[model samples]
Target: MGGVVIAKFLCMAKARKEYEAIVTCTMGCAFFGAPFKGSEMAKVALLYSSVFGNDAYESLLSFMRTETNDTLDEVVSDFMEIREKLVPKIELFCAYEEVPTDVAYAERMVNSPKMSSLTQHKFFRAGAKKLMEVGFSGLPGTHFVTKESAVLPGTHTIGLTVGHADLIRFESITSEKFVPVKMALTSMVQTARINARKRTSGQNLLSHKFVNQVRRSLEGVDMRQKFRAKVEQRQTTSWLTSEPQYQQWMAIGDSAKPLRSPHMWLKGGPGLGKTNASLAAIHTIGQTQLQEQQTESAGRNETFLAYFLCERSSGYDTAEDVLKNLITQLIDQEESLAQHARWFVPNPGYRGAASDDSLRSDLDTPASGAKATATVDNLWQCLQDMIEDPIVSSIHVIISNFHLLDSGESTTALLVKLREDAFSTVATPRVNHRARWLITSRDDQHIRSHLTAKCIAVIDLENDREYGGKVKIARQKHAKDTVTKLRQTKKYSSDLASYIRNSIESQSEDEKWIDSLCLLLGAMPNNSSSLTIRKWLREMSRYSINRLVDHARDTILSQNEDLTLEIDELLQTLTIAYEPPTLADLAVLTEIEDIQQLTELVRKCSPVLQIGEVSEDRNKVIFGHPEFRDHLITLYHGDSEQRKRYHGSMAWRCFKYIEKSYDRGQNGDAKGMRSLALTERIIDDSNVLVMANEDEEPDDAGPQVKRPLSVARTQSSTSIDILAKDFQMLRVSFSTTTGTSGAEMKAYGANGSEIFRQ
Candidate 1:
């Protein structure tokens, strides 16, 4: 079967374009059951020949013309009619069997009335059933047989009788005569695979790219040489003298001897050059040590160095996992060190042991002192060995993130022990001259408490004058660019900018207005917290500002007349809700009569509302900020009596809106129906309905008026019925009080009466 499929694929590939042309011509005739002309069948045969082999094409053509007794017109017409009826049915069966799988093809068939009905045929039904039985069902819940069609026991006749025979014969002839074509397809697939592999291999890893970019950026400047030259050339007039922070940094190594420390802490905020300084320090130390090692290696033959980042992951945050990663990366980078650190690998046999005995055994093995002792110990022990070595002792170990090293008590204890072990060697006369350690951290206290040695140095980054000035300049530049971009948007600050520019450009002899506007903007407290800004904006509308800051402030504030009452109503409703409400809920509460009006209100209030995107629901709605919601709530809740009176009016307005929506629905407006449904949903929600119940009592009694009893009864009954329906829709329950006794109403039928009350 696979061979046959492959053969067909190869034959299709050979004359794919020609076959497509023939298929296109036959599609309409096949779909309508119309007879094909003699030319049509000849065309199909010609395409088949071009696709398979020339000999087969000619043979089929000759057979069609000479073997059959029927006239070409009759034969061709019969083929078309058979194909017209059969091919569509076959396609319908294929659709039912596989559901097309391709969404585009399925959608086309579904949209076409003829194609949809063909799939409803008995043969297609049976095919679907067979497919389901074979565990190849396309979608669940779709029934194979319906009242209109029953499953029949047979392969799809259209495909088996018409399409299958021709396809099989074509494949058989092609495989027998087209060996070279089959090889070409195989070669093409292999070539694609090779190209894909090459493309993947050529892509650079992010870390390598970062390192190369940074290296290229620093290629010309040698930090150690530069620093030395700067120190040598320094008089009283250099930029270092002007920059206090630069002076402090350079002062650390100003003396003949390098600044000695048991540990170091560099503390600063983001973009303060702490990282750059640390990298430069490491680079200088490494280059100096490597050069010395190379000179000694000419006589002793050995090398030493290692560098690795603590934080690296393809995806997800792994900051806490940096320690283990750093160790693994270091091992991978240095082959000699890796061989010595085999003890770090967990023993396969000891699955869950907590003790380090298995690892200790691997590390404790004895060999020549020069090579065996080269194995890593605690950081301090490694430092001690470096100090002891005659030819290879001048090793400088640099470690960063000293604060992140020991997050827990146990790890902290281990780190303290390692530090103690290293410093113990400092007491030895020879050890002091052989090795050095550089550590960087934000907290000096954390390191100090552990080390207990006054030898460690703590550098406060803020004290660096040059670094501070650079940071200030960077921030100002960033703020300027941010303001520029904001102004360019024409939505945020563009209008304000235009107003400012126009006010200045069109200023009459009165220059006071322009000066006052700038003063007001400057004194506007842009530095105020975001919450303060929102509060200030809400209280200072155009009219309100006109009363406070004269006409200038009023002119700065823009308003649209269309937004007047709608915006006020929306704000009032939001104030009542006391929380950011979803659009559906807000529309209900506000008794918004028109969806378009509600949409416009939301757009107008965008600046004051602080709208946020809906997280779960894709439905159009905006959430106000929590503080803004709180402010509205305060306004609504301040006067309980007035609030109740306001709510009553709102509820009555909602009732009228619902009636209008229903009238619109009766008049055959789908929009009105949707609005009615939404209003009904809101009125039916327990929270809103409960509020309505509270405000149901009339404030003033008047003369009794005759009401339609039947109409009243109908509305009362229908209200309860709608409530019950909504409860069911929302999957909730309601409590009913019957003569001072309450019962839980769980389920209700279409009528107003409860069916399940417990």
Candidate 2:
């Protein structure tokens, strides 16, 4: 009788497997054609079990009827028995309850230095022994066990039980509420064991791999803290205006063409706030989703979200890493999705109503001339599964720095495929389909050309009313607020606001200066353009324009001659450079060695020179606005010989400072190095070296040039060496020619190159 019951159970398991195979094959052929056979089999099985009731299969039905006090323990033992006895014969379903606790324990054990050094195979062996001692030591007649659990209590639970038929209940615990906690626990334990084994199995496997994954999981907390800190710091002075352009973007998204395709593009200069606006939109969407979930009391398991910053400079010259990272992020959010999201693999054909042998043969068929077709087919199938899966019903993806995909050569093919796939999958009208795409990039012609063909809506930053229109008004109010706050802190005089106002009003009459400032502002990238305006005032030695105006008003009241001298000196200093100097650099140039005195001077001249935010690293300074640098450069031509003389010493000092501070390994120092280059040219053209080196010239009567022979010789040698090195580094060569037109330089790489005649 026992043998008969066992044989019957085996036969049932075999039949279930066959049914599953048939259903899977049919579904693979026509995914939406018919209901899965497995569902029908489950229904039939449930009905048959209801009628049997311990008559035809007493031993089998008796195990199903028995209930254990500890479901976790029972399920774990049963799952182990199924794994051993059902292999190559039957399929079993199991669940466990204390899975989280088991995983936590395993993680802790693996991280322990004393035990972690052991290989995963050895580690699992040891862990299994430890788990058996702790969880199954006292339990009578228990053979094997596995476990899993509810991540959140009262949500769900599952368990399995297997052993001697008389010792276990197989029928009584079949209610939906009766979770297989032991099976969940066992599964989690086994998962941990398998992970540990993989981590420690071979020379390629390093313990750090597990440690790093754990570390990555903790990164979100760190990122949140850092983001909060940045926001707080910026909030102190940084201001944001109500942007109508953002509303327009929302409108565009709302009115987006109802094709089955997904497309979006935000175009702007660096500082135009495209990224911020996009992020804001995404946040709004997420909040909306949260509200819907709250109102419906439905779980958010069906939603998928991912953001990718393609501007990050990884080694590859393509967006593959960015795409992969985005996918990985999405997968990590829902682990089950990871299995369905296949990459870099070709598809197998539809197995529709095919036998197991036929399906296997089709899958094994070699890819010859149909490689591309096979690949796309596989990808389409995978995508179909992902979209249809109940787990990932809605997906939203945001890719930043879309300009990175504009490279005409390397990324063209991949971008084409991605665009095709994106449009093909989403743009079409499909019931219950939900997906959205957002992309941000500079408004370059290349990007516009590619995206326009695909019918993507492009939002231009320059014309964005939200950011561009309200900037001035917002800045003025922000300035006022700043002054008010400073006064409240007792950090400055109460009259500071009026002083700054008067000073700015006075500058309104300087048309030339204002025009220079405007030009400078126009030159800045969208993101940093506002900073240009601030930089102008800082360079003008006006740390606080309010204070400067106050002092001017006071001077007018007293009729002081010092004001005249100060104004002249300030103008002279300001007009000497095409760019603004840092407070430290200015102090050194003016011989004002005292930091406090320099600060005071800057404050007094704030109307002309705006003081901006200071960098965390005190070695360098930033202007109130990058536009101010443009203004300074536009107003003064340091190139003039006389003007260069006034700035020579200061320029040389700046050059030395930049040389000392620069880190060649990283991106070059933008301000310092560029400023030094300008100054060096000024110093070089001023004839200062020629004059200085004249005394060291040989007494012999040569051409009687101002420059010493040795100095001229050294300069020529240095120039030749520099030219040679530059060519060598660039894998190019240069040749010089002398004709009636004078010296001409021609550069040649492996391919044809350019020529520069000087």
Candidate 3:
């Protein structure tokens, strides 16, 4: 018999949002009973309409109007294709059929105490009303109906039933109502096709949104730009490729064969170019990937590379930032992994695994605070899962400056786990794709303890004669390049250039010596004679880089007494800057109105700080080498309190600069202003934290009165210029020795009042 009555019931149930009942009754009526062929098709059409939403029905007419010329066979083929696409989208509809259908007892079960609570549910009330309308109205023999309920053979008829006339007669729409039958089938297939595509498109957009959200939260810096700069500068690590340790570390086997040693730890002293070596390995891997793509090999193993270069100056110092950066790189290589990371983007504080329940929990949990960042443990878990994905054939992870990571235990564990998995005695399918780690760092005790295992290989750059020779050669080349540039300056004559070149060659092995001599010779006044140049060479050759830096510090302090305060302020500002400030940035921060005077003062302090073009051709006054900076910091801020005091002084200068320069009434940058306000708050809070931890009581001098910009530069003992005009809204984060977590800064004003306290 036709399912006209069933279709009516489904429509009613759908109106009440009774999707479960519509799905259940349609499947039961169409599949169980000896229903007419046209009736079954009609019921299926109604099922698709109710489940797929109004758009599903509307799309059918559009499809039919455009496809009138298609053959019956072509139409059927198209319908089957659409059905295949819709299968995943309607899995829940199919699931309803598997429920045991004991229709005889369904009506009675509805009256049970267990169902009492559900009686108040919308679907229950809707069914109750239908039952009341069809009281004892069903066909007497085949179907049953009462004031409380109605029962059909194939479905648990809540309160709706077929009439006696509907049971006896079969309405064959295929024969008598051909148009209706054709329209029903066409609409059902068209609806499936349109809805499937719509759902897929919607899901794709949502997935991309999730990926973007996670990526933004990561705050990952692109190490590729830094890598490119190293390569462009001719800082080659090609020599590393020749080392036996390097050869073995970079070696890989087929999927069936395990990695002999997947972990490589490159330890060295500072300035040994370990970071460049890691970048070389990454560059080589990239070249190999490019070659593979060009070859179009059918069976080539896909290799994925994820790397993070940790530099404290760029805010990549914490273990959390490391893992987050690594995860970001991984997502870049395998975009689908972002779907996994999406679960944690809403609440990075949620450390649970990615599951339906955990995802719900993560979404439900609110972010802990305004600055709530991704947690290290959660990122670690996400990274581990990504590496283990079956689609990834091989993965190479390179982390440079591992020692710079504040909390590296999690990273250490991940490396260990990868190594163990690569060579595990117990074989597993997931181990088919293993991760290899190449870590470069100083010979820190913590790193040594973790990576000095029998299975891991450590390459000591300090003792490697070949590596040392390469470094010496590189240094000599750098010295020659410097001399060539100095000769071009015309400030040095032929004898002076030859003498400097000979001195550089003789001390190529002493990097600091070459570095110090280069700075001294470069900074020599144009009027200096050969005797003065020889005197400077004697002084440079007599002392080590450390002693030279100490001597330079003294020389800076021993300048004209009138310029002593100005020179000291300049030194302190340079020491506290995150990165070397440009001349313009320095001028604004130092409040040195005359660029000519600032340039002369910078040249006078050249032995301690040298002006050089660092990335992007921007000339900045930087230390000759990291060693010189270290020496200055040790000399001026050896004690933790002194360092905080300097930082506080710098924070105050940044606040003052923003206060004097920012004009709120004008159409100034709203975003920049907000950033400045936040920076001020962070500086103020940092000052408070610094004051709270002071070991001694403050003097009863109360608060120092505000000073004019001109007087403040010379009179304020704690004054240090940290605010560059361009970096007035720079991010400032500070942590204390008392184990307090880092907070954005706040500043202490002249009257001892806190500015931007919020």
Candidate 4:
């Protein structure tokens, strides 16, 4: 009991007239979660039992009654039985013992005594010692803490340890217990506050550096949030909800016998709910975590961690972006990580404590102008630390549409790194069994081979249930039932579902497609998100789909010279420009008029060509979908002559643009002529041009005759040179004094070489 607490009670008593009686107990009794005249330990022991009023107790009982022979469940039920036996522990609670932090009475506070700093300090030490005496059986070095153990409210654990020595010394005292304990208590607060502030400053120092690095990489990234929001924000009752894969994934949450695998690969084809599944997984995990957090007064240990969804059209398609953003979210979610951030601050010889200015120095650039930011290794180290943290049972990192990385080097390297994290056998992995990688991707060869090389676990939704027997019949029946349920809702119009299924050209993939189509059609029976439905509906409808596919077909196969300036330029432009090119960029690069011509060209290549603001400051024309882009790459890859012709077409566009510049002075004539001269010089060096020197003959009717020369330099992998040669006319219009045997023959070159014949 301390005078400081008595004053607080008196202050409160003045504000309220409900001070019927004063109750008091131990000064540091909040350690056992004790209340004034109440034992927290006894209360908790009773509540931890399956029969107790706690939500977790009830949850445990419900889980036990699920009737499972599963080893994990059996283990959990065994623990539940132990809890059941412990319900009798309630008998240990006393009606009037131990002090709650809330009601400190005058009797609890130190009374009259000779005031001295040293004597006051002694009482404060005993008070805190009493708190620790109740903590962990008070016997020290004998405790079983779960991996998911979290901080309870009003616990001064970290700061108390940092300033433990100072806590036992006091700057002031009153005449109580040889000296007043309240003065000592006041001294404890001042000292602890100083230590806590110092520790927080150091923690925030390291924390801000990590955050800045992550945010710098994600300057304007919003696609990840947008994609996650769409899926999570949608109605929960979808085809995905009822699926077995979803059920199996939920197994990740079973902590007693938690799934040991850190990585879960959700593989499927396009339109197979891979993205939707990622969203659903995030939502489900996050919701569960939030509920647990709400129910129990614990700090940042909630498990559904971070997710990154790759959308190629958005700037988020890059591997660097995904990794950085995921790390950022991890840091944001776990503020405790900041306390330990000094462990991950990349500065060499770091003492693990720094001031705000010292933090800037920690991440400062070197004299060589190289970055001092956290690298992959640093990020990896942080994740490893997070995994080792007991509060985090699992650090889940979900990535969707990994295939849309467009086979980038960043993508491949990132995948390999992720695979390493997934299956690292090191005693201390970046993320261990508790660290999960929930990924969704199409089963492309690159993805298959990369994952196979490392031997990771893959959950292919299409084959979630095998065929031929009870499984096959069940799946079929399930699919039919799903369709029936969906059909009852007006949202899943018969025309829409029929159109989607009937349009699929292959029958072998029908069962998988049927399930996917219906799942996508009616996410919920009636309350499927209007926004989601509208997006897919536009793409799923027969008319819009037909037009889109029609455009793709015409562009891929069109050889109509009339429509394409008799050149194969536009088609190649569509296939090869993997990076989006703005209309102005395309106009300049392709040498077409910027305004109407480029717009018309993109329109003609509709569906295949999508226009959007891909990057800041520039609107771009990019391929609408990853699958579509990959398909084009495959088509062009298979055909040799077609590829060469397109290459020639690309060069042709450049040549024609230079020619336009020369003829019309589009850019100043001097610059145009200089460009032309540069092209001719290259052509001359290549020595693959045709000479069109005139013969010793002159036209009988025309004043001057011109011959067009088409010449190409040898093949090149990067750049192709096309030259159209027309000799400059020398002023020799031979007005034939013409009766003399059909005019005399003459010849000339641009540099004037005249020839005569007898």
Best-performing candidate as measured by lDDT: 3
Comparing 2 with 4 on TM-score, the higher-scoring candidate is 4
Order of quality (lDDT): 3, 4, 2, 1
Best by TM-score: 3
lDDT of each: 0.35, 0.38, 0.53, 0.44
lDDT-best of 1 and 2: 2
Q: Which ten residues in a row have the lowest lDDT in candidate 4?
A: 735-744
- Lowest lDDT block of 10, candidate 2: 27-36
C-alpha-based local distance difference test score of model 3: 0.53
**Native-to-model Cα distance after best TM-score fit, residue 350 in candidate 3, in Å:** 12
lDDT of 4 by residue, 1-758 (tens): 12123324433443455651121111121121112221223322333342223565544333223233253333433422332332110011101111122212211333325433433686544643444444323323321211111112323322121121132344556423214235334434433333333334343555565544344433335544565445443333335555554455554343323444556787876545566667777777777777765742222234646877775432355565575567556656654554433433433324333232111222133211223333445455556665565446556678888887646555667777877765564344433466667778888887877676334567675665631233334345445555566657655566655543334332213244444444335433366655666566555444333233344546444833466551235544655542455676577456675568778766655545557643332367765444455455554444543443444344345444434433433444432232222222123354342222232344577553444222333321011111223212211211111001111112233343342110
- Model 1 per-residue lDDT at 317: 11
TM agreement with the true structure for every prediction:
0.26, 0.34, 0.55, 0.45
Please provide, for model 1 over 1-758, each residue's C-alpha lDDT reduced to its tens digit, 9 standing for 90 to 100: 12222223333533477554343222111111111111123334444454445664575454333233254344433433333432221111110111112233334544578767776777655543443343223333332212112111221212212121122233552564234334434433433333332222233322343333222211211223323432342111222123433333232211213334434445554334344455555555445545644551221222233322221111001121222233333323222222223323333222223432111223233321212222223332433433354333234444444543323443355456546655665565532433344555545565557655555545554666745565445434433443354345433355554443443333311122222223333334345554553344334322221132333212333455545566656766665442235675566667675776677667655444434443332353432222233344344445534443454444445444434433243346443122112111123222232321221222357543322111101110011212312122211133221111111213333342334322
Give the per-residue lDDT of model 2 (tens digit) for 317-337: 134334445444554554444
lDDT minimum window of 10 residues, candidate 3: 708-717
Model 1 off-target regions past 4 Å? 1-258, 269-273, 279-334, 346-398, 404-406, 414-422, 425-436, 462-758
Model 3, span 270-352: residue lDDT tens: 65667667877888777776665464231135567888777543335556667788888877765666765765564333333
Count of clashing residue pairs in every prediction: 3, 75, 11, 9
